[model samples]
Target: MSVLMSAFATLVGGLADLLQPLFHAGSAAAAIILFTACVRLAVHPLSRAAARGQKARTKLAPQIAELRKKHGKDPERMQKALMELHAKENVSPLAGCLPSLAQIPAFFLMYHLFSSREIGGEPNELLGHSLFAAPLGHRWADALTGDGVFTGAGLVYVALFAIVAAVATFSFRMTKRQMAAAPTPAAPEGPDGRPLPGMGAMAKVMPLMSFGTLLTVAVVPLAAGLYMVTSTTWAAVERYFLYREMWAAGAAPKASGAARGAGGAEAA
Candidate 1:
């Protein structure tokens, strides 16, 4: 673990050194963004795989729901049937998890890099870098309460928080769109005749989980916050392009068939 941390810190430090001359005092902050972007790009294949899994599940949703409705009374049967359906579709419930799961190690490396006062058993100089007047290693809360509150560092944190808020908003809207487009399962009824937990509602609520990022950014080193901002923004844009391609590709067949039908009608 120590060896890995040392190696990662060295890599990040080297990257920062290269970037240091480009920025005024925010070179570390810029370095964090660059480093994060590089890591995210390296994991692009995992993101693509995860996106494919999500697309598969979305396409198979109707059939899965039918299985659920058919076996609603028997939990064990429903589970087995769902498993069979997934197998047939070549989709795994864990498909959407791969991209995120793959990121855990990178996240830990960033966390340790920011949290540790020393890296590779030497004096850590990254902390000496700042975004504006705020040190990259300084926490938002510490900056707000200390003399930094009166300086440009305070504004830096405020700007970061704003970016996080924007990301959360975009995330919520994307999730809501996904939930709206997803096929809803036939919900079971309770004894009172009220419908039980609706899958649609659960899906919509899941996006709210993103708000936690704001809280996380508030307490971490500013460098990590910068990392989160750049990484998440990149993810949002990447998903947009990927989904656009998927939608266009999926629509092509239907579009061609519709065009042929119209031509036939015109001929007739």
Candidate 2:
């Protein structure tokens, strides 16, 4: 583990050196952002695969709904049928999670790198870096206690908060729009066709999950906060484009089906 930490520290230091000319004192902070972008790029293929899997699931909704209806009285049977269907269709139930899960290690590395005072028995020089007036090793609480939110480090945190809010809002809207357009068929329904028990409440709360990043950025070291912001922003933009492509692709089939139905009606 120490070996890996040492290597990651080396990578970030190299990036900081490369960015020093452009970012000056904040080069290390800039390096964190660049490193995050590289990580995202590496996991992009998994993201694309996840997108395809989501499209497949959307297409399978009707079949899944039928399975649910057929086995509604037996929860275990319904689950087994659902699993079988996904396997038969070559779609993974957890595919959408791949990109996010793949990023956890990188974020953890950044957090520990900045949080540590020593790395491999030597002083950790990266902790001395700052993003503008904010120390990369410091948290928002430290900024608050020192400068009280209107000066220097506090102002840097305020800026970070504002950017996070804007990005989170955008992500929230995008997710809500996607949910409306292609809702999951997995929401259990009671006999009267109402959403069963807590399902409706769960649906309502899911979109707001994006804003949870604000709390994360507030508590973690600034270096990790930078990673969170860059990653969340990238995810929002990537989801928008990918879902748009899915919608376009889905539309073509529906249009052809409609045309075929009209032709049959005229012939009849």
Candidate 3:
């Protein structure tokens, strides 16, 4: 573990060195952002695969609904049938989670790298780095207590909060749009033909979860907050394009059907 930490420290130091000319005192912070980009780039293929999986699952929703109706009374049978269907279709239901899960290690590394005072038995020099007046190793609370909110470090936090809020808003809207555009699952109706218990509430709450990143950015070390900001922004943009592609793909057949109906009417 110490060896791994040492290597990661070296990587960050190397990136800081490369960025020093441009970023000056904030080079370490810039290096964190660049490291984040590299991490996201490495996981891009998984993200694409996840997108394809999501499209496949969307296409399979109707069949899944049918299975749900057929096996609604038998929980075990339903589970077995769902597994079989996914296997036959070569789709992993959990694929959408890969890109997010893959990033956890990188985030934790940044958090620990900045939080620690020593690395491999030596003083951690990276702690001395700052993004303007904000120390990369410091938290928002530290800045607030030491210099107050209007001071340089506090203003840095303010800027970060603003950016996070904007990104979260973008993500929230995108999520709502996707949910609105998605085909309603022909869920197995309960006695009242309503969605399953808690499902509706969950749907309503999920979109707002995007704003949770604000709380995250506020609490973590500045270095990790930088990573979070970069990553969250990347995710919002990537999701927009991927969801747009999926929407277009899903609409093509409906468009063709409409054209066919119009042609039939003209012939008649």
Candidate 4:
């Protein structure tokens, strides 16, 4: 984790190094949007895979439960059974974990980019000027100390920060809800098909961390901050739609009550 974090920080350092020239062209917003687009595109495949894994789990929920009922205490047997089952169904149990893991690198990259204070040998010109003098659209984070801590704020900066904050927060809540679909299942099976406390356990904690972090965006330069929040919000929107489709696929038979009928309950 530390190595990946540092590598992303290094990415921030590199992007800040080369793209400083675009600041002069008054395209900081464009630059930010472009960078974010590239990052999202890079992670899209993993996101789709995770969605696939999630759908697979939903599709095979009954078999997963039966397997656990039979071998809940034997880790080895559980893993073998899961592998066999997944192979038969062509599903990757860990698929849902991919998108989250992929985002860590991009999240930290944005943090480094936003925390950066200088571009090239020149003082940073986020939207083409000094920190306080830069437009609200440009100053995403306040001017950071050499130690990389944000230092100040203004009315314009605060207002814009709030906008991004709201978008990031709402999108996150909506996406997670869409992914888990119905109330989160308790004791969700893990990748090895072993029964474990379900995602509901973490769901209770993540929202607090998410909202708390979103609230802190007011400390950054406006442009850098918006890039982070906006990209994340866009990713959430994209992910939710993806999950919605996955949900539809998994719950298809249920829509016709076939999933619940006694006549074919065993088949369902």
RMSD of 3: 4.6
Residue pairs with backbone atoms closer than 3 Å in model 2 (clashes): none
Q: What's each prediction's TM-score?
A: 0.80, 0.85, 0.87, 0.65
Residue pairs in collision within model 3: none
lDDT of 1 by residue, 34-58 (tens): 8888888988887887778778877
- lDDT by residue (tens digit), candidate 4, 110-222: 55544555434344444342333445333334333221333343554545556666766776666555545633355455656644665656655654455644554555545
lDDT, candidate 3, 1-268, per-residue tens: 8999999999999999999999999899999999999999999899988988877877777887788778877877877888888899999878888999999999999999999999999999999999999999999999999888989899999999999999999999888766655665523223222357777777789899999999988899999999999999999998888789766655676789899999999999
Clashes of each: 0, 0, 0, 12
- For model 1, the run of ten residues with the poorest summed lDDT: 185-194
- TM-score: the better of candidates 1 and 2: 2
Best of the two (3, 4) by lDDT: 3
**Per-candidate alpha-carbon RMSD to the true structure:** 5.8, 5.2, 4.6, 7.2
TM-score for candidate 3: 0.87
How should the candidates be ordered by TM-score, best one leading? Answer: 3, 2, 1, 4
- Which stretches in model 4 have alpha-carbon errors above 4 Å? 1-26, 113-153, 172-176, 179-184, 191-200, 207-209, 219-224, 246-268
lDDT for model 2 comes to: 0.87
How far residue 112's Cα lies from its native spot in candidate 2, in Å, is 0.7
